[model samples]
Target: MAFKRVSLIVAVAENGVIGKDNDLIWYLPRDLKYFKDTTAGHTVIMGRKNWDSIPLKYRPLKGRDNVVITRDQSFQADGAIVVHSLNEALEIAKKAGDEEPFIIGGGQIYKIALEQNLIDRMHITRVHEEFDGNTFFPQFDENKWKLVSKEDHAPDHRHEYSFSFCIWDKIDDSQ
Candidate 1:
């Protein structure tokens, strides 16, 4: 079976930080809303740590199918489908009829997916500020991706930092 699209969705800081410890470092409500809105009906694949970071009340992420990747075979997330690998998670999503599953991650999962070239598109919320963090988004070659769209947002009463929502599609070498 094949998928029409498989996207990676994340919020990164100017310095490439994605999180601190196992939780998000910043509190950008707009970015959170964007994530929820964009991936509402799709399957969200995440690592065990990422799944763990989600508050209990929001586990299974209400409107999405939560696929959690973990090495521990006995580990079970009550409301999520547990898989041993990213490929396994993808297969579950594919079998569930999700054409465009989203890889919503922790540091390791993102690195593995990128290294395996399993991503088709990326939806990124670029926060325009540097932060101190232990986890980071992997660096990718800009030449290999085409920026499809970008919408910039300025800081306001509700938002502390300026940010931009950017969509990038992987460049097809065949063309």
Candidate 2:
């Protein structure tokens, strides 16, 4: 099966940090809701660490096909499919007919997906504040992507910082 689109979904701080100590640095309920709504009926692929970081109680997120990528052959995640590589995960998503499978990640998985040019779009929740963290989202070539849409939101009761929901599409070089 051929897949038409592979996208990345992430919340990044102003300083490019995405997580710290294997967990998210912020608790933005709005962002969480946005994530759940956007990926509800699709396939979500993440690295093992990212999968592990999810609070145990709400894991294997309902209403979506979950694929966990890991190098460890013995790794098993209840209620989720475990694969050996990004390619394998992609194949599963493709077979599932999810044209826009979301690569929801840890730093390393994001870096690999970006480097492999496996991503066709990005759903970014851009937090307006800088954060100190050990895990950072990988830098990509801005020239290769174009902003498609953006919605800025002010800080609310459930959020501490203002943020923007930005969608970017990879520019087709053949165009």
Candidate 3:
């Protein structure tokens, strides 16, 4: 079966941490806006906790298909589709035809997607500093991917730290 375009979206610190205690460690309004603008019309698949981490007011992210992956078959997220596995989520995304599915994640989902070779590209926000966190972004072989684009942002009144928005495209050896 042909899979639709899939990408992983995340923000990681210098130490590779993404979150702590189920919440983001930093407050970067621009990064959040970048995320919203990029994933606005696409399908976004995330782990259950990641879905929950969104404030109750923003439970279901607007303007995109929100697929929450969880083990609980009875789990329900308002305005979001709850699925059991990554494959199921991808299948749903494929049915959408045009919009690519982006993995907006917690650590485990990121690791699984990378390991399963289910990602075609990556949108990573590289934070310039580190913070204490229990969750981390997974490590992967950098040689397997190519950096296609990047935009650096300097810290300002709204953004606490300097960061870079990086886009990586997966290299297909079969080509």
Query: Which has the greatest TM-score?
Result: 1
Stretches of model 3 off by over 4 angstroms after superposition: 1-4
User: For residues 26-78, what per-residue lDDT tens digits would candidate 3 score against the true structure?
Assistant: 99999999999999988899999999999999879999999999999899999
lDDT by residue for model 1 (116-164), tens:
9999999999999999999999999999999999999999999999999
Instruction: Please list the C-alpha lDDT of all candidates, in the order they appear.
Output: 0.95, 0.93, 0.92
Candidate 2 TM-score over all chains jointly: 0.97
Model 1 misplacement above 4 A: none
Report the poorest 10 consecutive residues by lDDT, candidate 2. Answer: 1-10
Per-residue lDDT value at 86 in model 3: 94
lDDT per residue for candidate 2 within 1-175, as digits (tens), equals 6777888999999999999999889989989999999988899999999999998998898999999999999999999999999999999998898878999998999999999999899999999999999999999888999999999999988788999999999999996
Better of 2 and 3 by TM-score: 2
Cα deviation of 72, candidate 2, in Å: 0.7
